[model samples]
Target chain A: MSQEIRKIEELARTIRRDIVEMVYLAKDGHPGPALSITDIVASLYGSLLRVNPSDPEWEGRDRFILSKGHACPAVYSALARRGFFSPELLPSLRALDSLLQGHPVMKKTPGIDMTSGSLGNGLSIGVGMALASGYTKKNFDVFVIMGDGELQEGIVWEGALSAFKYKLGRLIVFVDHNGWQSGASCNDVGGCVSVKSRFEAFGWHCQEIDGHDISAILQAVKNARAETNLPSVIIAETVKGKGVPFMENDNSWHKRVPSKEQYEEAMKILGGC
Target chain B: MSEYKGSREAFVAAMTDLADKDPRVVFVSADSLKAARATNFAEKYPDRYFEAGIAEQNAVAMAAGLAACGLKPYVVTYGGFITMRACEQLRTFCAYTDLDVTFGGLNGGMIGGEREGVTHQALEDIGIVRTIPGVKVFAPADAAETYALAKAAGSLKGPVYFRLGSGREPDVFSPGTEVELGKLRKVLDYGNDVLLLSSGFVLDRVLKAAELLKAGGIGASVVEVHSLKPLDADGVVRELERCQVAVTIEDHTVIGGLGSAIAELAAERCPCRIQRLGIQDVFPESGPANTLADKYGLSPQAIADTARALAAGKGR
Candidate 1:
């Protein structure tokens, strides 16, 4: 494996471990979706994104928004590990007055480009950020990560069409198609046959990849950045509870906390927190 | 009073002037440019202006997005569609995050779109937008106030919802009435028998109603409450204490708009007999602005009659 890819893979595993540990501590949070996007988020923060850890609000830095804000434990972990905040604060997840909220709030959390908890809002906010970059004659890219079921929101399609109409080459979105939504699977809920086809219809340059593959996530984002005319959407197919064997693809893990015993097993499988 | 001008026209003109001065100002419309009087703005600043094509939710979200990137975005659409249709987007992205985007709701109240039915009327918007935290809501009474409010909203640092009356409103303020935010403008302080505290274009009617009350030998005080939210409670209480009873006159629902706000304030601070003059609990059917205003007891004569009855009932 290339050095960068190997390092990103390691970081992804650590982040997955952080996700399991943080949720285990809080005894609440959406762990399934967070685990699913660990690799993609890891790759973005680890290699691709041009962000400064010291200066989280760097004007020239690229922006990333987790539109699926319930899955914020993963992002919080990524940000913490990337040195935006101390990893010690991870245990304070969901705590009152803690920086880490149930959902990502930009004002509270460092390195959060947009405050997003309500699904389908981030992409639209991302479009605004991208529009700002264009209007201000800046060259920073904006990446918005959304969930598969979130596409059901009419606002997502509205933002999708807008991004295209604006021809925001600087905007990139990734739909984590883990196929599982809260309490049910995405197919049973929204019945969206293919994310690739939906985004293609919306006039975005499309790519489908195994979300767990660090190399694939990096390569897809790299290819997306090369295109200068249209916005891109990488439909990353992933498992709901990716790393842990017991939780993997299990609908029950969508918002469930790992019990003490299950937590031990989960941490062991994730190579320890 | 100065010459009558459309509040919507004043809003569009102020926006156009703001965009001309500040390059950061961008106007985003939901295919209501003609209705919002933004055709000239769109033509002149084509690069800055964006048409969301009848998508209020999208336009609102996009405005939030545009505002997030350091540009001031003014979203224009009918009051009914913009506030009710894109309510969640405005709450979540704009108000929740506290982005500096101006939500310009044109045709406020039952004034405009007489033929378009109840869906187009904006009687419930003030109440709907009032419940949201960190959102500055205003209903400009005339063209001058609309222009001032628009300019203020553009310069303000947070989310603002400016309810613009339909075009063709008589001027209530003098030519250069300085529209300071969060301050009540007392249009007429004839007497403190009954204070007619009003907002939006209804202030013009309130002033006229006060005149009719004077002619009928019923003393009345008229206070124009242009700023709906962060409601100048001190100013309101100052006026309320001087009067035995206060009536809140607005072009919105009596539920959560200025009427409810004043009632709540009065109950807490200056407890007095409070009367709310607005649409009761039914959806009013569409008609001509004047016809609807008359039917709903929003006309000068009807308002004066209501005030006379209220004053007589209190044995003033």
Candidate 2:
């Protein structure tokens, strides 16, 4: 592995540990969803996205939106680890009056680019941001990470149509295809037949990769950036509650808090003290 | 007949003027460019105009995004579509975030959607939008007021929803009327035996009702409520205190709209008898705009009758 890839993998491990700890400490959060996107979040914040942690609202910086905002533990961890805020704030994930909200609120959080809690809004916001980049000649890319089940929202397709119609090349979306939703499997609830074909039908550049593989995720982004005439969607196949053996692929862990034994087991599995 | 321009035309003209002054001003249309009378704006600033193709939800969310990027974005479409179809997007994306997005909702109330029917009319827009926190709701009485509010919205710092009329609305305010936000513009006042509180395109009817009340030996004061949210509560209360009874006339449902605002305020501040003259809690059928207005209790005769009865202490 290249040194850069190794560094990103290490960062992903740290972010996963942070996600576990944050959810465990808060006693209420979507840990499975957060863990699913930890590597993808790490890949973007640690290696790909051009952002200034000290200056969160830098005009020229690329923007990131976690559209599946219930997964904000991963983003909060990524932001804290990248020096946007103190990592000490991670434990207060859903605490009252904390800067970190249960959902990603751009006004409240320092590093959050868009306020998103309602599913299917982030991509449209990204389309607007990307359009702004063209109008202002900023040339900054807008990235959005959505959960697989969020595809069921009709507005997501509407955003897809706008991105395609406007030819927003700077807008990139990653569908964290973890397969499980809150109540049941995503397919059982609402089967989005062939996520790749669906986006491709909208004339978007499409790629599918292992979401946990930091190197592959980085390469997909690189390829997405190369395509300047269309929006790109990277369907990242992820395992819900990844990096923890007992929690992996367990839908019950979607929003459940871990017991002391489960917490210790998760920490040990994540290679953290 | 008094000369009048379409409120939609005035809205587009004001937006065009705003765009001419500020380069950050942009327009997002949901396939209603012609309906919004925004073709002139599109022609003037082609690059700044976005066509969202009948997707009001996406249009609103996208406008929120543009606003977040420090650009002033105006999402223009039918009032029903903008307020009802994209209600969640407006609440969560724009109002909750407090983005500076100016929304121009055309065909507001029973006076619009002449042939398009109940599906197109926006009788509940003010009620739905005003309930959302951090949203400034404006239902302009005339083209002049629409132009002034649209221009003023450009300078405001938060989300604004402008409830506009169809192109055929009658002239209430003359040209070059300076309409301020959150201030009640008094139209006419006699002995203050009854207060005629009006909003949106129904102001002309209310004015005619005041003349009828005068003919019936009931002195009436007329006040136009353009801004529904951040309402001039003290001014309205003062008028309420002076009058023996207050009647709220709007081109909307009596529930959760101008009438509700007046009733809520009067109940809290000054206990006064109020007869709300609007749609009487029923879905209006498709008909000519004038016929619909008359059937829905928004006619001049209805307003005058209500005011006359309330003034005589014979109203509900």
TM-score of each: 0.97, 0.98
Off by over 4 Å in 2: B1-4, B314-316
lDDT for each residue of candidate 2 in A1-273, tens digit (9 for 90 to 100)? 999888888988999899888888899999899999999999998888999998998998998989999999999988998999999989999899999999988899998989998988889989999999999898899999999999999999999999999999999999999998999999999975988889999999999999999889999999999999999999999999999978899999999999988898888888998
Query: Model 2 over residues B1-316: C-alpha lDDT tens digits?
Result: 1123789889888888888889999999999888888887788799999988879999999998888888989998999999899999899989989899998888788777767878988889999998999999998988888888877777888899998877898887778888877899999987788999998888888889899989889899999999899889999999998885889998888998999999999999998899888878887877888888888887789888988888888344
Taking the candidates one at a time, how many backbone clashes does each contain? 1, 0
DockQ of model 1 vs. true complex: 0.75
Give per-residue CA lDDT, model 1, range A116-193, as digits (tens): 878888788788788888877878999999999998998898888889998988999999998988868888888857
Least accurate 10 contiguous residues by lDDT in model 1 chain B = B1-10
What clash pairs does model 1 have?
A128-B65
Best by TM-score: 2
Best by DockQ: 2
